[model samples]
Target: MTLAASRQSIPDDIWAKMQGRSWHSDRGCLPRKNLVFVTLPYLNFSGATVEGHLIVHLDVADDVMIIFTEIHQSGKFRIEKMSLVDDYDGDDDKSMFDNNTSAYNCRLTRGGATMSSHGRGIAIDINPVQNPWVKGSETAPANGVNYNTPDKRDAAFRRGAHGIVMPDDVVVASFARKGWKWGGVFTTRKDYQHFSEDGM
Candidate 1:
């Protein structure tokens, strides 16, 4: 039950992985200097503890650590898998399909060429397969479509679903305590896996 998170400057090896992927030299993305690498402990559905290496904006690094530490303390939540988006070569689709829970990417938010909180390293997505992005009839990961239907959302009070986020769950509460917005509340699209500083 002893979970931990250590935040530090991006190591040379990880920085190399992010180059041209989540970290871009030009086009004015968030600077590498403003990001911090965090090593965190999270549990998988089977109750196995996994160490997650993540990068997020320095502004949220401490908050992110505390939030996740609370989640680990609860021990009821689970994340199937997590990794840097850079490992997926910056292809968000691939990353989502793999259910790679992560934060930060060098990409614009949908609908325009604007940097999202994620692009600025201020957002995180968790358990994409269980908490998929839903818009109309389609889900981002396709696998998630079966997990988070509107009916299931109403059943959130039950809290039986494994990786799906619920209002009463530690995941939501932990993020909420930090004043971060849950994308699950979005009217346009339901991004259940998302938590961000700006609600984007």
Candidate 2:
């Protein structure tokens, strides 16, 4: 089925939930009209089919659907959950803790002034618990640091662990084919849960 069948402008009710949480008109975010809600079909670790959602820039919405469709067909990987940032009220921490894969949150990098790729809806975070964001001694999702270890990381590629994304995995490959960059390759800090247009 063509995924284009599902993308749409944000409804007023949905926008209300995202107002202060994920989108702020006062901030330098793109206009809501430039964003689209797209459906992503994927598989669970057990190979069960699941439908997901994302709010992304219109330019990348189709790309996101294509990438997820590729990964879903491969059946070589899985995601814990996939939804918009507003699902958790734009709480990145709670989303990570709950392992919610998502895109489009009009926030900055590490809550700083620098806009994140996510702010532009050009980035997506998947399975944050299994693939945490790491910087120095810090790791996101509170309990995911151990996955940074070689042994644990190997489990991801080997499919010994669900929701963990490996560099060579279909999840990464699908996005890569669309010119997105995986955050797992970051030199200073590895953010295995991240994938974006610019690789940041």
Candidate 3:
């Protein structure tokens, strides 16, 4: 489907989860689809605020509705329980910090060397265990660079494909249609389940 159609086709449930959240255009960019990239306000483990962005593939109106639903259901629904990782300090080197140290436990990484698109608050990393970074060495790389665990090697593949896992494809597609890029497609390695606002 065309990007525009995809954006318009966001699930009602997801759309209702986004409402009243302030949007900063300077921090983000709009893509070909009806997607609007916006910065997200997040709190770090140290109680510091980190700003990031995600290229929301769904229509703003629909997402607003979804946000409302998420808020209304809050503790009652599993889908409504969105958790942010504590390691991201929202700094420009979040990727470096997250990858090099266990501080962030390799939960998330900054997109690039400078202020990453994530720093704008429009991107996200769902669950790390289910989407562990693929690295070249025996241990996870310190730079947050990752490759997808081979489906055969990854025990979560079955659960991931069956929807019992994180990094849902629909969610990824929703974001991608808006020109957001998934880290799964990284050249050196494949993240298979990572998504981002960088259209690259």
Candidate 4:
């Protein structure tokens, strides 16, 4: 679906709050099962897009509202949920070349070298258990394989049927249509739930 359509899925009140603040007119949107996500526009070293996206899940909309209210009460503005996994990698003092995956292995590593997108707060991995990073070395297990081993994940990567339950894919497609790239499409590793403004 187009970005505009995704944007329309955003709750009116949430949209109003996001407008002119955390989100700008240039940002794009994606609609998922009971959620509307707004993606930021930024690029990564792998030519992947990275940006902040507001994820509002219908089931957790109330929780989001509470978080926003709490932030506002504390005099904070433009609040966005920064994943803890992202924070840990940013604070590490080890050699910058370490192949650290942080929370999601969205980062690329060559030998001992490491790369990350969480430092910019542009990419997000949602409900990681449902969407896992299957390594090339091991045969994918059945329980965690949502549709079929790699087929389901592959379909999701291509923006097909298997992506329906993944809110991130919707966000990815929204970004892709706008010239952004999803981490799932990367040649080195497939980050099934990663969506960024840069082309990975």
Candidate 5:
């Protein structure tokens, strides 16, 4: 069923918590008028399901999950770990990446000069440990160096180490089905952890 068709609304407190970021400003980011929340099922890497929310622009609410049907049909809907952006406490990208946390932080682009799709709730960063950002010789979490390769591994480095998410991985495929762009395809820097509405 569609978000509007279901007539569901995210709870007040949960919605508040999701937007509790210090970078929420009246800048170029999408205004509150264009944002909405929808619940999405989060699956751990092990295939267990958990409750999660997907913040998105109001215009795309109905179409956002078109890919979910294909994923479910293919038995690939398992999210492999999902959480709200408010779960993390700081703006430190490296720290959050190290912990393999997924959130919707409202911060500027990596350079902090302009608003990021994340700041507008149009983008999401998944398992950072498995999908760490890469620029030149630097990786978001130093430990994620091993995942920089195009090889996607289902299991983490050690027992709990983050797994590798490759371009053709189920996660990327699901997001792609929804018309979102993966940063791993970037030519210069690879933000393997990111997916955005417009590939921003």
Candidate 6:
């Protein structure tokens, strides 16, 4: 879908949700500026709309375009839910890592020194189960610990076969075009599901 159509696709109620200038203490990740809810043409593996809050920035819109285009091009079909992780079980990574899509959760960084990009509304996680976070020997979703390989041969990480987004996928280029960075390219740890304005 084109960018204009994507913008038009958003309904009034959904747009309403995007409004308001109040802080959600429960979901502390709301950005202090340029915060708005954007309903992208993204779909879950089952074909549901992949809409969520994003910073009011061009990069965020472009990133949505990439996800929308990549899925349409891949011709893959499967069952899944793309949701804000915080909505599922607060900030729990274990519960959020199972094939969910989310952005803007108010929370400290993984190491706790500072707020994460998500907390700033500039980062997102797509299909966390397929693109599990790998830190040393630990994986966010303990069940996905064995599916760490970037190789598409693994059913969990398979591209068109199972809806996984790999490093080489067009989705990466999509975000890259907007100056957004992919966590899959992180040097210290691999957060395959993550993408952000600063590559956090």
lDDT of 1: 0.85
RMSD of each: 1.9, 2.0, 11.9, 15.8, 4.3, 4.8
- Better by TM-score, candidate 4 or 2: 2
Clashes of each: 0, 0, 30, 11, 3, 2
Q: Return the TM-score for candidate 2, rounded to 2 decimals.
A: 0.92
Across 1-200, the per-residue lDDT of candidate 2 in tens digits comes to 43322678988888888988899878888898899988777877676787888898999888887888888877778887787778888888988888889889988898467999999889999988888988887889887876875577886557577877876778888898999999898898888999999888
Worst-scoring 10-residue span by lDDT in model 1: 152-161
lDDT of 6 by residue, 102-166 (tens): 77555678877687787676787776776778888788766565567665325554334455666
How much is 77 displaced in model 6, in angstroms?
8.4
Q: Give the candidate order by descending lDDT.
A: 1, 2, 5, 6, 4, 3
- Encode model 5's per-residue lDDT on 1-200: one tens digit a residue: 32222214555775566454523545554665566665554445676544555656676665555543344345443445455555554354644454443434567788658767776666767667667788988887766677766543334433344345565767678787778898888888998777888898
Ranking by TM-score: 1, 2, 5, 6, 3, 4
Q: What TM-score quantifies how close candidate 6 is to the native fold?
A: 0.71
Better of 3 and 6 by TM-score: 6
Q: Pick the winner on lDDT between candidates 1 and 2.
A: 1
Local distance difference test scores for all models = 0.85, 0.84, 0.35, 0.37, 0.60, 0.59
Instruction: Give the higher-TM-score candidate: 4 or 5.
Output: 5
TM-score of each: 0.93, 0.92, 0.41, 0.36, 0.75, 0.71
lDDT of 3 by residue, 86-119 (tens): 2233232343224211111111243444533333
Q: Compared with the true structure, what per-residue lDDT tens digits does model 1 show for residues 60-159?
A: 9999999988887788888877789998998888999998899988788865778877898889999888788888888889877666676865575266
- Candidate 2 Cα outliers beyond 4 Å, as residue runs: 1-5, 156-159
Poorly placed runs, candidate 5 (over 4 Å): 1-10, 18-29, 77-80, 90-95, 98-103, 151-163
